[model samples]
Target: MQGAWFAFILTLLAGLSTGIGSLIAFFARRTNKTLLAVSLGFSAGVMIYISLVDMLAEARLDLLGQYGQPGEWLALGAFFAGIGLTALVDLLVPEVENPHHAWRVEEMESAAEAARARKLLRTGMVTAMVLALHNFPEGIATFVAGLMEPATGVAIAMAIAIHNIPEGISVSVPIFYATGSRRKALLYSCLSGLCEPLGAAAGYVFLLRFVSPGIFGVVFAMVAGTMIFIAFDELLPAAHEHGEHHHAIGGLIGGMAVMAVGLALVR
Candidate 1:
């Protein structure tokens, strides 16, 4: 019971980090493009590094132990399946209202801006919905990882939290601009974040009963794939779009270095 509660709290904290982004949108004088870029890059680096080195390796070990060589292919297949699912979500969402879009707070501060903000509102809402959906599996992944290994869970939560900061910023700025309601903006951001805990709860209640080392390993591989895809498809591009190439690259390296060190220390 304590372990489950701990997982819930960690997942909840990660989800609520979006509120941090909401606060940033409301208070910051200007969007720190360089910081955002480097941060996103760093998020990507950490995610990619973990997927390739830590989580994937864990998955391979467990699968090989359980089902011999065939389990190896199964784990690898699960990783690709994750990428396909994310890609399908991207395809289902409309291009104009794509969830990956980011906007600045200043752009939405004027009455004259309402027209532009209206368009952005659709994008923000759509992004929120998409993010909520994306976060569901992530919540489960985090919960399960935490249940299995607290240290890995903490690391995963940190990486997810870092990227979610930008997501919160993306969700809040436009909606606030469009409706001129901080309450509404914060509500939406918080709601989207709530999905993480909801996902964790659901996954625990329904999925935990069936978990085995093999199953856990497979899910870990898939989640690793999901993070890698998110980093490449969303974080990197967004970072480059918002900030300079050099800053983004530097952040990416820094993030990888940090994650590597964290894993090493845990080991």
Candidate 2:
């Protein structure tokens, strides 16, 4: 019960971190492109390294224990399935409104064109909705990681939280521009983040009745795949878009190093 509570709390904090981004968008005078770029790259590095080194290995072990040699293939299939699921979600969201499409604080100025206000509002709303959809699986991934290993969960949650900041900015910029209301922009940004916790709750309720080693293994692998997809498809590109290539790469290496050290200490 305590562990479950802890896991839920972690998920909640991660989800709410989006609000931090919204706040940053509202208050920051200038867009810190280099910092944003490095941060995004760092997040990507953490997710990619942890997903491959820790989550995948853990999943393989659990599956092997449950199903012998065939478990290897099963883990592989599930990993790809996770990637496929996220990809499908991405495909469903129009490219224009996809939350992964990068936005910065500077854009807020340009977004305020009076003629485009209505269009901007619609874009913000659609982005919020799309972001909610994307966050659902991420919520599940974080919750499951918490249940399996608290330390890993913390790492995953932090990485997710970092990535989500940009998402909040993405949702808020257009909305604030359209509505001329910081409150509305912030509200919508936070609402989109709420989906993360909602997803965690939903996934937990459903999985509880069917909990087993095989199920755990499959889910872990899928989560790993999802992380990998986000890292490569979203985080890296967005990082590069925000700043210099070398900055992004440096941050990536720094992130991996930090995670590696943490893992070593914990082990």
Candidate 3:
């Protein structure tokens, strides 16, 4: 029960970071692209390390116990299925309006807003909706993984929180520009984040009842795959794009090293 509550709080905090990003976008005079880049890179490293070393390792072991000979293939299949699920969601959103793009402060300040108000409004609303949907499965994956293992859950939670900050900016920048209401923009950003905890709560309530060793193993494997995809497909690229040559790489190594220590201490 305590662990469950802890997990929920972790997810909640991660979701709310959208608001933090919104706040940064609205209030901060200067954009710290380099810091954001390093953080994203670090998050990717943490997620990748935990997915492969901890989550997937445990998943494969449980799967093997569940189906001694066939477990390997099943685990592998589930992993890919997770990736496919996330990719499908990505495909559904139009490339021009993908909500995941990190918006820069300079760009926001310099844009010709009066001319583009109508377009920005449409883009903002669509992006918010798409981001909300995208976060649902992530919420489920995070909640379940945490319940399965608290240490790994903490790692995942931290990584997700870091990853979502730019997303918050993505959702808020256009909306604020379109509506000219800081309050409204902040509200939308927060609401989008709320979907994560809501999804987590629903996932836990509905799925916990039916969980078995095999089910747990498969879900964990899927979560691992999803994390890996997010790391490579989203986090790393964004990080590198905004980063100085070595900053993102340095952050990545630091994140992995920190996770290694945590894994060692936990074991």
Candidate 4:
């Protein structure tokens, strides 16, 4: 019960970190492009390294123990299935309104044009909806990982939280500018973030009766696939868009190194 509670709390905290981004959007004078770039890159690195080194490996081991050599194929299939699911979600959302499309805090300055306000509001609402969809799988990933290993859960939650900061900015900026209401912007941002915990709760309810080694193996592999897709497709590109290539690369390497050290110590 304690472990379950811990995992739920971690998921809740990760989801709510979007509110931090909302607050930053309101207070920061300018988008710190370089910092954003590096941070996003760092998050990508952490996710990629952990997904491959830890989650995938663990999943393979679990599956192999259960099904012998055929388990290798199963693990691979589950991993790709995770990617396919995320890709399907992406295809459903129009590219223009995809929350993964990075938004800068500086956009707030120009968003006051009355002609564009309605469009911006629609964009914000769409982005929020899209982000909620993206966060659902993440909530499942985080919750399952936390249930399996608290340390890994903490790392995954932190990575997801870091990336979500920008998502909060993405949803809030356009809405705040469109509605001229901080409260509305914050409310929408919080609502979008709430999906993470909602997802966790939903996954828990559905999977509780069937929890088993095979289930863990499948979920871990899927989680690895999902995180890898996010890192490569979203985080890396967004980081490059900030125009700090070297810094982004440095942050990536730094993030991997930090995760490596942390894992070594924990093990």
Error of 2 at 89 (Å): 0.7
In model 2, which range of ten residues has the least summed lDDT?
A: 106-115
TM-score, cand. 3 vs. native: 0.94
Q: Report lDDT (CA) for all predictions.
A: 0.80, 0.89, 0.83, 0.87
So what's the TM-score on candidate 1?
Answer: 0.90
Ordered from best to worst TM-score, the candidate numbers read 2, 4, 3, 1
- How far residue 63's Cα lies from its native spot in candidate 3, in Å, is 1.0
Off by over 4 Å in 1: 107-124
> Which has the better lDDT: candidate 3, or candidate 4?
4
What stretches of model 2 exceed 4 Å from their correct place? none
Q: Between prediction 1 and prediction 2, which has the larger TM-score?
A: 2
TM-score of the candidate numbered 2?
0.96
How many times do residue backbones clash in model 1? 0
What lDDT is reached at residue 8 by model 4? 85
For every model shown, the clashing-pair count is: 0, 0, 0, 0
- Residue-wise C-alpha lDDT for candidate 1, range 182-203, written one tens digit per residue: 8988989988888989988987
Task: Give the total clashing residue pairs for model 3.
Answer: 0
Clashes in candidate 4: how many?
0
Best by TM-score: 2
Top-lDDT candidate index: 2
